[model samples]
Target: MNKIKLTITGCLGRMGQQLIKSAKNSKNFKLVSLTENRIVNKKIFGLKPQLNSISAFKNANVIIDFTIPKCTLEVLKIASKLKKKVVIGTTGFSKKEENLIKKYSKNIPILKAGNMSLGINLLMYLTEIASKSLGDNFLSKVFEIHHKHKKDHPSGTALMLGKGIATGKNKDFYNLMGKKYLNKKTFPYSKKINFNSIRKGEIVG
Candidate 1:
């Protein structure tokens, strides 16, 4: 009957703030530490945010990251060294960086996902089933919309859907991945998985 000590990275970012609020309300976790890429002098929820370091994460049972790829790798490095479990919700990692994350997992337990929403996961599941049921005649494309401030095109959720389609087809995700279109009104569905991302004002779709 122990609470998990949690650390959230990029504590000033959107998801980081959301995680802090959610963790504050959760009974199963204690928010032990918060971290950012740079020095943060101000305190959030009675805890000062620190830069990613061994000292920052040495005491945490689990670390949740919602930052960019570089910062996530930094967290992984520290977490791997400290032997801490990590949950990654960051996106926009290149295939090479993705491989490096897998390498980091060899030493420490890590659970990484582009999107962690139940609805999104369910959508991915349904996409997989549909892909399998449709067979070769039907081509597939993933389209998504997000807030304008979000920089990564095709969004992580869109990519997740792409992976689901690949899984259903029994193809490698990287090999099956096709074009990524941003702010486009139209796109084509090829033999592989294609993606279209629409960025608008303040819509979390």
Candidate 2:
């Protein structure tokens, strides 16, 4: 079997580090690039990705991005232009940014998920079923954990879980940004995504 050529954007992140370790242990993958603001030039498993720019990965078979919301669009544009398969693991995209991603997907194979780990995916599925079974009587909340430096208030995984709850109750996303400003009753929903974010000191990069 031939190896799948892979490049990782946001390569210094937790997810990126996980992928790097997995790829090193697997016989089926060959990592060709590692793009991040930090640690881009570091060698992995004795193989250095000869790259000075993201465009160096033009021929890469797959590009997995875990970059921040600020960088997601620019990276997606590059991937679309190269006609490469993309796996988007970034989160916190605005409505306009999401529509742009949809537009870009028409040109190539794209798979977008806030959480890429198989376990998290199953959790979302189960949450949907439980939400449906439990019905509108219960309100839903969102919570998550990440490295101490994570900037987003609610983790992407938390929001994905919230969406699963909405599916169970059959409701659209309730933008919980401002309830008191708009008067809470204007949008009717018993369930809301309550997010709790934590930032603390941690040594693992």
Candidate 3:
């Protein structure tokens, strides 16, 4: 049987590295390319990393991206032209950027998510149900904690929960968005959903 051609972007990052190990161990995928924003001097798993471009992704059947919003968009643009499928696991995108991704999806198949954990997705689904069941009298807020090294203010999972709240309310997530606070001891609940994120030593909850 032929293996699925796979290109992994942000090859040096934590998620990228994890995907590399997982993909290498799996029989379904053949890691054809690895990409980063800058040039990589060393070879990883026998393939040198390249910058995101049409040429870099031209030969792949699918591209899995675990990069920032900027880099993800760059990869999407090239992948759209190449007509390749993409799986996006990156986070921290504004409403406009999210819209841009939807636009690209019109041209090529794309699967995007803030978190891939089954438990988290189930939690998100539950949140949507609760939000929808609750009346307007109830207020909503989100809190999350991540590794100290994580840079995004509100983790992708937090945004996903907020989106759940919006989905329940039958309102736009951006329109319902409230202030985003990082490492704050306290935050207020408003007409819109608020998000508070705490970053410290790795906590998996």
Candidate 4:
């Protein structure tokens, strides 16, 4: 059987490194390219990381990206022209950026998710169910903790959960969105969904 050619963007990030390790172990994929936002002089897994460009991704069937919203958009532009599929695991995009992604999807295949884990997806589903079942009698808020290096507050998974709450209430997530508190010991639940994010040690959760 022929292996699928793969390109990994943001190759220096935690998820990027993890993808590399997994791709090397998997029999279904062949890692064809690695790209970074900046110049990388050293070689990883026998391939030098290049900047996100048409040439970098031209040889791959699919590209997996886990980076900032700006970098993810850059990758999408290149992928759209190359006609390659993209799997986006990046988060913290504003409503406008989200719409931009949707626009790009009309040209090529794009699979995007806040949290890719099955367990997290299940939790999001349950959240929506609970929010709908509970009704307006109760208020909802989201809390999350991640590694200190993670820049985005309220993590993507947290936002997903918030969106779930909005879906249950049958309202827009942005309109239902409340305050975003970082590293707060205590926070209040409001009519609109509030979020509290805590960044600490290198915990992957």
Which candidate number has the best TM-score? 4
Note the residue pairs that clash in candidate 4: none
Clashes of 2: 0
Error of 2 at 102 (Å): 1.9
Q: Which stretches of candidate 4 lie over 4 Å from their true place?
A: none
Candidate 2 ranges beyond 4 A from true positions = 38-54, 174-191, 201-205
Ranked candidates (TM-score, high to low) = 4, 3, 1, 2
What does candidate 2's lDDT look like per residue over 94-131, in tens digits? 66787889998999889998877789889999999998
Better structure of 1 and 4 per TM-score: 4
lDDT values for all models: 0.90, 0.71, 0.92, 0.95
Roughly what TM-score does model 4 have, to 2 decimal places?
0.98
Higher-TM-score candidate of 3 and 4: 4
The candidate with the higher lDDT, 3 or 4, is 4
Ranking of predictions according to lDDT: 4, 3, 1, 2
Error of 2 at 40 (Å): 5.6
- TM-score to true structure, per model: 0.95, 0.78, 0.97, 0.98
- Report the lDDT tens digits of candidate 1 across residue range 1-205: 8999999999999898889999999999999999998988899999999999999998899999999999999899888889999999888898899999999999999998878888989999998998888776788888899998887877888889988888888788999889888888999989888888998899964
